[model samples]
Target: MPAPRIKSPALLVAESGADREGHGLRRTLGRFQLVCFGIGAIVGTGIFVGLSDSVAQAGPAVVVSFVLAAVTCVFTAFAFAELGGAIPVSGSSYSFAYAGLGETTAFLVGWCLLLEYGVSVSAVAVGWSQYVDELLHSLTGLNLPHALAAGPGDGGVVNLPAVIVIALASVLLVRGVRESARATAAMAVLKIAVLVAFCAIGFVAFQDGNLSPFSPAGLGGIGAGTTAAFFSYIGFDAITTAGEEARDPRRDIPFAILVCIGVVTLLYCAVALAAIGALGGDGVGDRPAALSHVVNEVTGSAVGGGVIAFGAVVAIASVVLAVMYGQTRILMSMSRDGLVPRVFEKVSPRTATPVAGTLIVGVVFAVPAAFASLDSVVNLCTIGTLATMVTVNIAVIALRRREPDLARTFRVPLYPATPLLGIGFCLYLIYETGPATWFQFAVFLAAGLLLYAGYGRRNSRLGRGGDQGLTPGDAGRVRQEA
Candidate 1:
């Protein structure tokens, strides 16, 4: 068998331009909409629900853990920014690997991205169900029965809310990207306002004594907290997945990413401090819906809690929408490369969207979310994400060496040191995720390898000499017509 080929940087740029102009995806997004996509994906379950567990693990020191995780993400975001600007493809890091590494490595990165985006959407949907239940109870004093409200593992027949939310988000995506972006942007604004409200109310009840004896669990606890907190930062990279959809991808994608990291990090840290300050680590950690509960306790009313719960419902739905968008786009890119079925690459002429791909991803993810236990799958998602970040950082270094003259709208400030630290931080966090997660990741990768060997290797267009006789422009036009 022939070795897997690496796509040249110039070829990638040319092909992307062709895809943008042909019957491919539309480029209607601007900087504001792009930044909203990042925020919409980032500020959901992690801050709204997962904060309690992080606080439990690190006590008052969870604030520090949030910062550490953000620092790690910032380093990686730089790598993403540089590449997203230069390559400007829907595949994000997967495309970066293809351009700088080889076809095989690109397939693996795309496979891991499937896990990162697909499974994470399911996990977020499951979290959304909980908030829906909370909001319903607060509003009408009625709670969904266990059989209807949760998955089998949680003593329920099916998580109806999870399925419903995923379905709604999928419908919106099928309608079109512009519509989805508008919905996500609105939700982003509402969710940010909700968090700000929570912070305001939480500060009113703040006690200095609650923050005493910070770092109660010591460095070990902080490390564990960092691992937990890192999950919140997972969705920030979803920004780069919109490379082909952005109006001016080279400038705007990089700008949106940096803005997203700064805004999300500030919100996370503020919420952490507020929750700990209002109720102390132990108080906040003991509650199920910690943010809502904090607001209710501080305001001495269920109305406050109800509002927070409603905000959570909106916030997490946007996450499902945005992350699902990312997943479908990745699949579309992989299909275009002949790494997956061609149906994924088909763009609806009417909607200018991948309707079939969107529905496929939504249905595939919704089933696991409705019937299976995904509590542990969250760790699997996090580890898969960390693996991709490591690849992205490496791709940066590799691309710089391979294409020194490629135009970059944004560059990693410290170059080698920044990406190296990103790799190191990701590896350390992966270690902190424990041997079980490592084992799960290995199994997933093994399965991906077998699938690639049996299918992707035989079907890859580049392997079949599809681009052999053509220039980059011709290759892209042929792909569009195919």
Candidate 2:
């Protein structure tokens, strides 16, 4: 009657068990696969292509920026881990908000996730195309025509390689979660190995003078570099999106998240140090394939560069696969609650995946990857992710207060302080995005709210009195399923 503001944690838990007969997503992912998934998603375009820009912003002090960004993510990751264990659902932060915040707030969080995961898939795919062209030229001394190699805004007819990579990732997702996990695991290993090799080669040429006057632009430059580096950490939280599909989500999701943050942080710092030490900030320049360029410069061999380019290709592809998987699952959760079309909720019994939803995401995002410039949209993605993370941090506090005795496998060490810091850090990063990014994010939120008012509010399952029979006690009984 009052606009279905909230859904009790118990009801959400009970509803998760509705697929006991196996019509929903299958729980084939374990701790190892989830770790790989997080790694696969986190170590892509940001390191391969975006590092040069961060170096330019802060000189050699980009290493410190990497640490600062990781610290911000660590705070939010703790909040995510705590809630992820308590409410293991595919909707992730959206579902957490629905239970602790309200239906409208949940819809908005889901809308933000659309920007974080859906647009991210296209953005990563576009980055992948550059590496593909690099690798092709290295191997065959030939390259894709400009018209087929870049988005129209980049002076091309269409980005054919970007579309192809998205299509490939979508097909893997439609086949089944287990198959996708295996492919991701393989690529994850390859990419990590490649990064390790690059670090090794770069360190051989390390010179102390290259790292001198590290904070060339002082605090201001470091802060800007941190903002640039923060985008590299975008996919670590994606581990929680596998809640329904994790074999023991309550345990595995949190573990995978923490491990992912640690692994990615160490790798990023190592790569940043090695690149800056070997060539200095000026040498890194502003190249699209920064990592490969560094390796070539250090060794004076195109072969080394070619290998790094191949790794970037694999790394970006894995991000596309893992992030696209997260996007479809979130949409499926939204559809289940009648906030979107029912087609998204349909699962293929044979594959045990959301076939329709995955395909739709692939097609919708690929168009932007093919035809539009993503320079501005990348900032939009960063803002959307930060906003949702702020919601997640608050949702952690709300759920703790609302469900005081709810069984939780993991708990934030400092309770209110941790989530509070997470919120502050997220908001600060959001502020650093500048006025133009804020305007774009405001428009995105306005469109989302308009859609919710027009359709989602009326059709929500809770608004239809569908939760009448569910009670708080039901949560304890269905804890394992959740």
Most accurate candidate by TM-score: 2
Task: Provide TM-scores for the models.
Answer: 0.96, 0.97
Q: Which residue pairs clash within candidate 1?
A: none
The collision pairs in model 2 are none
lDDT tens digits, residues 1-482, model 2? Answer: 66547987667757766324353778899999999999998999889878987898889999999998998999999988988888778888888889888999999999999888989888888889999998988788898998999987889999999999999999999999999999999999999999999999989999999998889999999988888888889888788888888888888889999999999999999999999899989988477788888888888878898999999999999999999988998898899899999999999989998898999999999999998765646788989999999999998888788788776788898878888998888888888888999998999999999999999988988888776676555655655443
Indicate the residue-level lDDT of 386 in model 2: 95
Off by over 4 Å in 2: 1-4, 18-23, 471-473, 479-482
- Residue ranges of candidate 1 with Cα displaced over 4 Å: 1-3, 18-20, 469-482
Give the TM-score (vs. native) of candidate 2. Answer: 0.97
**Model 2 residue 465 CA deviation in Å:** 0.9
Q: Which residue window of length 10 is worst by lDDT in model 2?
A: 14-23
Candidate 1 lDDT over 124-162, as tens digits, reads: 888899899999989999998989888888788999999
